[model samples]
Target: MQIADRIEQALDRAVALAQGPGAPPLLASALRYAVFPAGHRIRPQLCLAVAGACGDADPESADAAAAAIELLHCASLVHDDLPCFDDSALRRGKASVHAEYGAPLAVLTGDALIVHAFATLRPVAARDPSRMATLLGIVTEAVGSPGGIVAGQAWECEVAVPLADYQRAKTGALFVAATRAGAAAAGVDAEPWRMLGDKLGEAYQVADDLRDVLCDSDELGKPIGQDAVRLRPNAAAQLGVGGAKARLEDLVRAAVESIPDCPGAADLRMLIKAQTALFFPKQLAREAA
Candidate 1:
């Protein structure tokens, strides 16, 4: 609740700024529509969880990083659902930004949210220049080239999209940033925690793959089976349903094992386990059984 509250407040403030008297009403509303009511908030929660495990040297800065990661995530979803991309009409049980506010505004709204993501970090940068710089790089790289979300999205356009690369960039990059930035915010070396985030992120993507195949729109709070509809690369398609479930289980185990030695290692491990249960829902397990 604390983490969610912080995110809500920050998003509200950002949207409020964009809702100035001269601001377009629907655009401002669309921004709020895309962010609010929140999803699982898993990335930001992981960020806060990692910071807590790492000692939380600066709570305020840690909060900022979590907020920034979420903003970037929301921005990605908005852009991802545009007509040019996934063409998803629903998000979090509501109309997608593009569906609700038209495509052009959706594009600008996504762009504005990306800018807000960085702006959200400025206060942290002012408080600790080093941490700020590190976080800036972490977030930028997570959403940018080589192995970022952008690259991940681009893989869909490729004639031959590598499964590992696409999954990592499209989903894992932000998760990596979450854990690494959390550790960085807490004045620790973020490298040891990198694999934990990667494994978790991979697990997340696999779970999503299963969900898209096994679930329905009402259950998922969004459109399901989009990968097949769009002909995009998906684990369930590449590996088959059983194989994807096995892969998801393997990633979950690896994620739990990858937690490095830290002051709160035990708690972090437990956190990973609890989160894993959510990823591998009881229905999934039962259906497989």
Candidate 2:
């Protein structure tokens, strides 16, 4: 099967697993609503690709890792759409969970997805329970606590939080987790492979910041100008749009360079290229007129 097709299959199965069979009708409905017709599932796709490049990727455990990480991502999006947060009514070009299911159900669906992420990991956990436990701990830490995405969100409330800290927590954490989880799933235990997570995570953050400035809401499928509208600090705010795009290119180059260029990293190199291609001058093509 083609690589993208394989990733899509894993994503579809994850959407189903997140729903499960015995969930309450309300919960099942929420699950279907939150995940179906979702975004690209890029996080899990990145994980699977990295795993495959590195080694066998052990089909048995790779799906578990993909499904678990996807649930985590879906949960984050559900919470992100809450009234207290982005407070948006649209996601992926459709009404968000709260908009369609009501606030209470939306909250529960987010909570449930978080729990299911770990639950989905049980099979891989069985392969070597202790290692799985460690992986879960890393994922949980990234999603919660003082230095994670939850904390990243909380920073907006703070009187003085570093922009780098906020961006890393909010965007970079998941990229880091995806790579780490992929390495674990592949049963590879090298420091270099593990470190790929951090590099990719930071690279993605830079790319996202560039997009928020250059891309329109119609293209992004989320509210546009959110950072500028909210007066939040962004790469575009600190560095000009032209400069932010440059930073993105630099980071992508750095991220790809951090990993040893080899047969294993060939596809990963392509993935990085595809991501950075959209960031700059085209953004001002019309404005230049």
Candidate 3:
């Protein structure tokens, strides 16, 4: 099956598992709403791609890892759009979880998705108990304290924060986790893939920064100028449009170059090039050209 199909199916099963009898209907609906109609599914796609590049000896485990990564990402988005954060009304061109389901349900939905992300991996332990520790560790670190997405979010609350540190934790953590987790799921050495994730994740954040400044809400499906409004770190604001675009291009090149030597390296490189190319908004691309 295609990567997107695999991700959706795994996610559907994970959501279904959470929606058993006696579950709160609103929370269940919120869970479904938060995950469905995924935006790009890029993180999961990267996970699966890295797994494929690494031989994908355990496709089932990789799928679960991918699903878990995506669930965490979705959960982050749910929380990120809450009133306390970006207060975004729309996500993926529709009402955000908090907007559509209300903050209480939205909070529950994000929490539930985080739990379900770990739950989705339970079957993997049954299939190959040996892989559980590594998988759990990788996923946990990506979303947990000191250096995970949670830390990334926490940075926003701090009195002072470094831009690179904030960006890495907030955005790059999961990408690093995705790449590392893919290799771990495939029973390969995951360390070598970290650089690729780091570069790509930073590139993605820079792209988002540029988009925030250049694109309107209608184009991005979320609030624009949020960086300025919230005084959040933004590469576009820090580096000018031209400088940020150059930085983005450099990161993309670095990411492609960082791919570990594996069977699918060439294809992976092509995929990175193509996907990162889309990071440039049409207007930015035109101006750059």
Pick by lDDT: which candidate is best?
Answer: 3
TM-score of 2: 0.88
Cα-based lDDT at residue 106, candidate 2: 94
Cα-lDDT of candidate 3: 0.93
User: Any runs in candidate 2 off by more than 4 Å, and if so which?
Assistant: 260-263, 278-289
Ranking by TM-score: 3, 1, 2
Per TM-score, the best of the predicted structures is 3
Q: Which ten residues in a row have the lowest lDDT in candidate 3?
A: 280-289
> Model 1, which residues run further than 4 Å from truth?
18-22, 287-289
Tens digit of lDDT per residue, candidate 2, span 145-259?
A: 6666787788877777687788778877777777777766777753465456666666566656666777777787877777776667688778887776567667767777776
**lDDT: worst 10-residue window of model 1:** 6-15
lDDT of 1 by residue, 124-176 (tens): 86688988999999999998899998898889889887789999999999999
TM-score of each: 0.95, 0.88, 0.98
The lDDT values for all models are 0.87, 0.72, 0.93
